[model samples]
Target: MTQQKAVLRSDGFTFKQFFVAHDRCAMKVGTDGVLLGAWAPVADAKRVLDIGTGSGLIALMLAQRTGESVAVDAVELDEQAAVQAQENAAASPWASRISVYRDDIRHWTQRCEHRYSLIVSNPPYFTPGSDCATPARASARSTTDLTHDMLLNCAESLITEDGYFCVVLPTTAGDRLLTLALQHGWHLRFRTDIADNDRRPPNRVLLALSPHPGEEFLDRMTIRGPDQRYSEAHCSLTRDFYLFR
Candidate 1:
């Protein structure tokens, strides 16, 4: 089935991203990407890799926050999304520092020789039996496109010994992924659980893992407070990327 396309305008953050057009992918630029981008670690990273780059949102965010000191590379499996990502990168202030490739993460890792200080992915996390309204959506949300094992393997191969691997996934799959990481000898460094509001259970887990880690640091972030307004923690976490604090 043919995928439907959409054009997304920038939210006027530092990155000022504009997704010209995209199809054949389930996910688009949304709150998840923004939250992940703003929350990912970027303090001392010299080189970064973004897997399943999609609209290149995370790459742009890293570029905006890191300046030209850090080089960012993005990998996308979908041809259309890759093209759009390149365009978005070119349009950004850090165009010279960002590069987008139309390749799968598994293939990219096999050919990658340079090691990254940080790797981030807002990957496909929906498990089986979840509702998928369309083929494109299924491809966007399912692990079939890029399995957890594939991501972990790439992380092990592409990241340096001291580098960090970070991702945001559904809470259900997050624990399982952490288990898989432990099995692969990777250590969880930091974690944050997210909920829509104070009343709801955490639906997403944001994690940062590394090879040189002692003990995992776990935290929680509630997106909204009891008033149904943005929580102070959430606002602070996203203040750098969002137009309004």
Candidate 2:
């Protein structure tokens, strides 16, 4: 039998419907972005916003999940990453539905007149003084630039009355965000605690909040089962976008 070899590259990631080239991005493709993209509620979303759209992964995913009538606007602060996101969106099947803007979310909110039905972000959660390997990574990880309060305020300004604001964060940061959101008059609609394995406590949390109050929905998910394989829940949740699911 003839033998063949496959070469792997680190510059980009391939999803089921689109490719995200992140070589220029400080934060490369990661589970948090994918989870938020796949897990965020998108039904009947006429317009969607993706904050801090590095590599444009979530924006592209939202474009794929949404119908022709839906429009997705993505904002990124980093110049190189914004260009990369734009290129990725242009290459995707839903190019017309996605718009990439190289601007801070804070400024974008001021200029944007239209309200979005849904807004999502895999935001920087690391506190200042957190150890990081690079300045770019530090900017992408640390909250020194984008505080939770600022994020919530921006969402409040841009979201429709009944719109949903969703984010994925570390458990501790997520808990703080919950409190902050409530203080800002936003009500929690859904929460999902995420863990690496069945035996460990959840290390991450997915939160969906809105201005309108509703009965809170809570759930838990583990990325890996006891067998050390991808859990069924994880697979099922990401099956639509993950190439291997």
Candidate 3:
């Protein structure tokens, strides 16, 4: 498939993102990727994998945090996205440490030789019966692209015995994912519920899972206060990467 190049402009950065110039993929680089990129755990990680690495945002962020020695791989099913992810990685400072694979996660897992110390994803969570305006959006948002059971199975197979699997998802879908993880013997290690503001209910959940037994560390994070400004905690959490601070 021919790849079409595009550009994305945010407050702090201008990025060239590639797509099938004319294809259907519901998601583009958005706030969700930024949040997951900035919030995922990476300390002392030797090997990491970014599943469904749409824009290579999370992999680049990991590169920024980890040393040059770490190895990072990203998997993308969309051909255009895979190309774009490679372009993004090449343009970043951590280019030498990151590689992009244009393939399905299920197939990639079968041939992967080494286990990753960290596995992270911002997965498609919208389940069946949800409202979707277009085929692209449905593909990007719905579990039809990658089911929860499949994600769990892949994580169980790809992650090392002590590795951590981190993900961000809508709170509604997160509940089902947590239940499935338990059934598969993947223990929940940490979780944070995120709200747009203090007055609103949580819309997203960030979670870390592992095979080792441990109690869950649960917390809540509100992005904004009543003043409609970023909360101190939010700023602190993302200050390292975000230009707002």
Candidate 4:
């Protein structure tokens, strides 16, 4: 299959089953969010949580992948982004299965009694002092508002005994999360190093962690091949959700 290059639209991103309108979101639809949405372990996830669900992209993706029995909750802190997320989910085919909450995950977790079987986040990984174009973008990208420690603690409190907490982060930041997860008694279940091309060192990593210890799976994925086309492995992983794959 010839892979059609994906264009990043300012208004929204159109997937195979739904459209994500991200005009009001600080963070627009990007490869990291899409990658985490499509690749996270969702086989038996009865209840899923998407933290910082800008435009509700990952939540909607999970809703599309899971059975009708599943329910997905999306939490966002930013008002505009949260509203956009809610609108996006409401417009999707899986509207009934997805719920959008406009609150900080830490606050939401305190009031919520539900435990999730699967939780995924394309979290704020940039260093706190890094400069961004806008305050909203800064909040979305940097750890000042939602630090790694806070995220791990929130996930730890909300996850069931056998639940999986997955995230996509830049390789350096991912390593920090890995260390923190281990320190917090979470075990690594899977890891995927991703690079723009095989010749380049990985710039991003997909990590799946669990409360129970298990054999860890590690692999590498290159988004583009030598000819600069989408690699077969990347295409295979995302084929279900990408319209032009």
Candidate 5:
């Protein structure tokens, strides 16, 4: 187990077909990114866009899911992280189908030529005024740099008429994000509340929204069971990404 940790440490984390390097990025790989990458409906998607793609983890996961024919593009505002994202994608088996850019989504939406079938973001949702040692960490976690309005406007401009936008957020921010999404002509298409255990309140919400309203799909997921092992549902959702799961 110690040796296994060392290997994972060297490679960041190993996925079925790719490895993500997050040492230089402010945000390391986490469950939120994995859940959003897998839960998103990408089977029919031809062009996918990932915003704020720190470490390129979620984008790489999506690239694996979408296949070689589908094009996946990601944008990261942090320059160092963007470079790391580009490198990660370049090293992946699906390298030819993935592209990473060092640009802000707000600006990218203005001139984006390709219409995306799906757009995703595990956005920074925390409000300002918290203490964080690193500027990058604070920027990644707090909305002082990125607001829900910015993300929604970019999605509205870049997504196809029938396309979907997916995201995962802490429950507090997720509700507010959903409210904002509704105001801007985006409606919930699917939703799943995520809890660590069956007994605990949901800490995160995975959401998918489309331009047209439909019979909203809803579900709940518990990450761990009574035995303190991964719940079956959680394992199934992430089996493709986690090594030796």
Candidate 6:
């Protein structure tokens, strides 16, 4: 849980398998990011790509999840965030398997030569009228930096025929993504609606899109238990990485 704090490192957060330094990032590590990272399928992943890899969290997670031969390519546009992501990757146990790029995903997608077996992104989701103050935060929150069409088109072309592109979005913003993916010939093969607890409604949606349209698998995840502690499912999903879990 991003809501849960790590053993306070001087400049980073500690996990059971890795450490992340996000103070230089506009967007610090959050639950949505961590959840998307852990939940993204890596069953048979060979080469993976992580777009908008803030603090290199998801890329590192994939490195930790994949077989020893798998290599992870992560892209970040933010200069400071990219550097921090690079540093984080270098310090991790899977340092040699992860590479951090300091470039915009839109541009990076153009130059990227590798076709990934799995692609995951946690892009900016704030719609047109949000009260964001700083440029970094705005870049992290607003969609101006990376559009749905740009991400989908690139993913459609770069992903393997059997590959899947997964993303985490706000519940409301997911509608546009669903529509966009269909328009681009990608299908929503799986989705998970996430909520804080069993009582409250979902606020986030995790989507998995693929070139081949198949039966849509829908599911739900609650982060906390009735007693307000971490849920069994949440803990189990993240048990491999989180120390407290």
Measured by TM-score, the strongest candidate is 4
Could you give the C-alpha RMSD of every candidate to the true structure, in order shown?
4.8, 3.2, 5.4, 1.6, 1.8, 1.8
Displacement of residue 178 (Cα, Å) in model 5 is: 0.3
Q: Between the candidate structures 1 and 3, which one is better when assessed by lDDT? A: 1
Give all TM-scores, in the order shown: 0.89, 0.96, 0.88, 0.97, 0.96, 0.95
Q: How far is 81's C-alpha from truth in model 1 (Å)? A: 0.7
lDDT of each: 0.81, 0.91, 0.79, 0.93, 0.89, 0.87
The runs of at least 3 residues in candidate 3 whose Cα sits more than 4 Å from the true structure, single-residue gaps closed, are 1-25, 128-134
Greater TM-score among 3 and 6 belongs to: 6
**Residue 198 CA displacement from its true place in model 2, Å:** 1.1
Off by over 4 Å in 1: 1-25, 128-131
RMSD of 1: 4.8
Local accuracy of candidate 2 as per-residue lDDT tens digits, 1-245: 10000111488887778788999999988889989999999986989999999999999988888899999999999899999999999999999889999998998889999999999999999999899998888998999889999999999999998999999999999999999999999999999999999789999999999999989999999998897778899999888877645
Total clashing pairs for each candidate: 0, 0, 0, 0, 0, 0
Candidate 5 TM-score, C-alpha based: 0.96
Best by lDDT: 4
> Candidate 5 — worst ten consecutive residues by lDDT sum?
2-11
How well does candidate 5 score on lDDT at residue 224? 88
* Cα lDDT of model 1 by residue, 3-82, tens digit: 11122333222322433233434466667777788888888798999999887888988888886778999998878778
Clashes of 2: 0
In model 5, the number of clashes is 0
lDDT of 4 by residue, 37-115 (tens): 9899998798999999999999999998999999999999999999999999989999999999999899899999899
Instruction: Compose the digit string of candidate 3's lDDT tens values, residues 1-245.
Output: 10111233331244222121212234665667767777777885889999988777778887777887899999988887687778777877777899999999999999999799899999999876688887756766778879989999999998988889999998988888999999999999989899999889999999899999887799999988888777888888766665435
Could you give the candidate ranking by lDDT, starting with the highest? 4, 2, 5, 6, 1, 3
